[model samples]
Target chain A: DPQLHEYMKLDKKYRSIGFLSARTGGAPHVMAADEAVKATNTEVVSIEMARDTKGGAGHGATIIFAAEDVSDARRAVEITLEAVEKNFGNVYSSDAGHIELHYTARASMALEKGFNALVGKSFGIIVGAPAAIGLVMADTAVKTANVDVVTYASPNNGTARSNEIIISITGDSGAVKQSLLAAQEVGLSVLSSMGEIPKSGSTPTLI
Target chain B: DPQLHEYMKLDKKYRSIGFLSARTGGAPHVMAADEAVKATNTEVVSIEMARDTKGGAGHGATIIFAAEDVSDARRAVEITLEAVEKNFGNVYSSDAGHIELHYTARASMALEKGFNALVGKSFGIIVGAPAAIGLVMADTAVKTANVDVVTYASPNNGTARSNEIIISITGDSGAVKQSLLAAQEVGLSVLSSMGEIPKSGSTPTLI
Candidate 1:
């Protein structure tokens, strides 16, 4: 009975699980998820736009499917993917503006766990308005200097404004600093040139 | 002894709790929290920006404190409030653009819990990007029709992009439709006149 109980508990969690991370994340998966369920006898476990997309460097959403058999789980994932083939999300970084930076030479224990994995390491915080900016910043930081994006949050799961993206990149002190500067500089330059209004004032001035 | 154990468990939850919902919500409470802990013998329970600031129709944040005694908890809340008095958060709502709408006359049980309180009411959804639009839309809806703001979510705790705000208002079907149209019309007119760009494409081009 004890063994059966354990097995039953584990079984209830699901016998098989399949995952699909779309190219860019969004909530349209609900529509595609319906098609997935209708085509296969599987349950959609979770579906949401990811705080960070594009393999953790861009914007996108993810979905998980569970079933009693591996075939059913796999089929569900495949159907969802096919259903969304024509329309998927993408990180539109070029529209980003309102950049903010907070860099730490050495993270202390007082920092939130979002930065906990970065203790003792140097990290740079770059916030971009219009979440798409994270993709551009992440790409810029990693390419400009040897840094890894430790945290990527969009409005989907981050505390930023719905149009904002928060990126935390970590590396050696020198690299982090360099990466942050490059990312911030590039973001401001491009955004400003495009006439992005500053993040203050209520009405957009006709200027 | 059993009763004593129950009492101890309750004590761990805190003998007293004090709450302070700021006019707006954001993560800046971390700084105020530091000052509160330094000045009082209470624990800062939770602090964050609310999805809907200004009493569910505006933008803001909230903070909670707990302590072993009522006096300690109240003092912690006061200290935190006092520390943030000069720089409490506020919803910057005039900078909204990129709007989408989804309305439902009747809700099925499958709807997200955010709409549960509104399941039986005629609901109109208005989404504005940059998280500031919710304030304007919420204000307009209430003033234009006999409706109540049922759900308010921003990038802080919503599924929107960091710059988006989602507001759901409920009323009689006619009222819901009228309010939605009025709010939507006002938003589009003002935003468009301000040269608010559409939500497609990557870069903002000079018109």
Candidate 2:
């Protein structure tokens, strides 16, 4: 509880935030992250290298920054982008595709939650498909075990066409393992059935 | 700084984290979020309503939670999933297709960055396409104004096929506006040229 209290206080301090994501990874990504930090008076929150399930490679990296205000955060993002382009223009094509910037006037619940999860002691994750199937999996996972549901999302990890879904849970190691197993059963079933769906001619063909 | 100190303390407290995302919105999503909280000794991190950019509709919501340990977090996720399914089976298909869960053993840099961005004062965003084109746009935005680039991504908003890219920046109202305008010019250019590409005869034909 005291920690939670501290978190709340921290949440209030950096009322501005910024997120940068690139589709490619490696040196450019690292350089960009560094530039962002140097560009403004902000703290680096995260630097994540996203996996590419389809290509079986590193898809990209997402960098997050916390700034004292929106202006500083914005400056950081701009500096990083420019710096990345200047240093690694060629890599830009593969890495610098999806870029997003969002700012809030107050503490963001989503960010706080993400931070809490990051500092957590234990965690579990489940990835599946067909959004609907994932829900079923999550339901089973929770029902069969004593765990906490962190979050779930569709088409995560750059598997947009795959329709894959992901579910995350946290708890004691035993509970997490039990929950994951239960969820895996559901995920595997869905994955197997996915291939069984009879080809429907009605599927739209993009011209 | 005091707030940040508090945040660090709080971050140390919750060593386990979890996340759950549902594709459907409204009652089912809300119900699941509530259930997860009630089922465990965890803190709610975020509840987000996703926007369906491609389909032009509401995608659903995502819930994040923090717990004292992994076991509690896992339990929370499980409870929430079951409750949502029991109450809204039909909505599950539309909203629950994408489910994901994740856990961490220690502090997560990514989560912290996300939190910082979320709490920022003000921000700007740009969504473009073809990863490379997005980079060009990012360059233009930074070069044209005194804005900070928060983040950017390719084929954003779940449109893996669409190849749409998104970019975000933050700064003073004037700078944000200027940066967005500059980026928009690049985005429009890319969008316009997208249709002029000659179709290849060898394009795969799905039966």
Candidate 3:
């Protein structure tokens, strides 16, 4: 849509804005967005799947939430992250996929706003999934590790059904490591549950 | 990715720019970009798969071609389109898919830049399969029918493996009709060749 220049600013009441990009399933992305809005006092400012060349969910889904309080915004984002963290990369089919999650506690180089939104922080790389897994990962990384995204293809978005998602974040090397660890932990549990229903008697809450 | 705020000025010599987005397989997207550059006097400016969530090709792939001559740029885009047009939606497997192609010669509403880069041109829609078919369709429509795209989804990107692609273009009803017909014709030939070798002793040239 070429109305790319169209814009509006929220009043001071909506001074804080939270964004979530579930780079994976539309099912998960929509669900996460729904949960975020329902679980918090945030308003859905914009929500839509990507309309890239193929149009429609070509790039998965993105949601923006606005709140009067930054904490509320942050919390809403965290909720979305957790939702995506758990849902996006899971393989519900008979266990047929590999989950390659890595944990790095230290990094050497720093980057600027390279990941989804990380800035001036050395980054860690994220790769996993069937589609659009990077967005949700960033949502989680920012919340859990206080890192900024360095960025790139959520991974294998180019490869038809590469089943790999990748994301990079920047922060103190420790934060980058934490971000990677946090995402990898969730990835293992979710991807490991392929074809098996992991009991979720309790509603998913942001950690 | 946040350096989105950065800017550049193309020299007058490179005033013409062509962009191609193959919202489907990374293989096809890269091939198309390569073919575009090889086939014409255009320079590659940027090329990458989507990084929406899982990052890396989350949205397929996009390539930019810059040329001093408008024809070169347009031709480059057309070649990319033709390349994508032929490659993206094919099912090199036994025909197990349905090809739903529609032709609408008359459009009811006017839109402004709704599809790809189409401006208030009263659009026609395109939808077809595996991934990002809409983009290559737009490239064809713009070149062949002189129509603009009225957008919203290549379709089914949000849905995991829905195998659907959609895009809309705007123009005179006649042009819209032509665009649809042309795309449908191509889609039928390409998709119908599923799992079979359609002899292509002759290279694909823009019609």
Instruction: Evaluate all candidate structures by whole-model CA lDDT and list the values in order.
Output: 0.53, 0.47, 0.48
Fill in the DockQ of model 2.
0.03
* Top-scoring candidate (DockQ): 2
For candidate 2, the per-residue lDDT at A132 reads 40
Q: Per-residue alpha-carbon lDDT of model 1 for A104-169, expressed as tens digits?
A: 566533223333434566756665543434445555776787777676654434542234456677
Rank all candidate structures by their DockQ, best first, as comma-separated numbers: 2, 3, 1
How far residue B97's Cα lies from its native spot in candidate 2, in Å, is 24
Task: List per-model TM-scores for chain B.
Answer: 0.45, 0.39, 0.37
User: Between the candidate structures 2 and 3, which one is better when assessed by lDDT?
Assistant: 3
Residue-level lDDT tens digits of model 2 in A1-207: 357436534455777777788764333444455546644787766655554323312235677677778988888788777755543432211111111111111222222333223232455544433344544566677777776655544443323332334455667767776766666555555445544422212221111
lDDT score for candidate 1 against the true structure: 0.53
Which of candidates 1 and 3 reaches a greater lDDT?
1
- lDDT at position A100, candidate 1: 52
C-alpha TM-scores of all predictions: 0.32, 0.32, 0.34
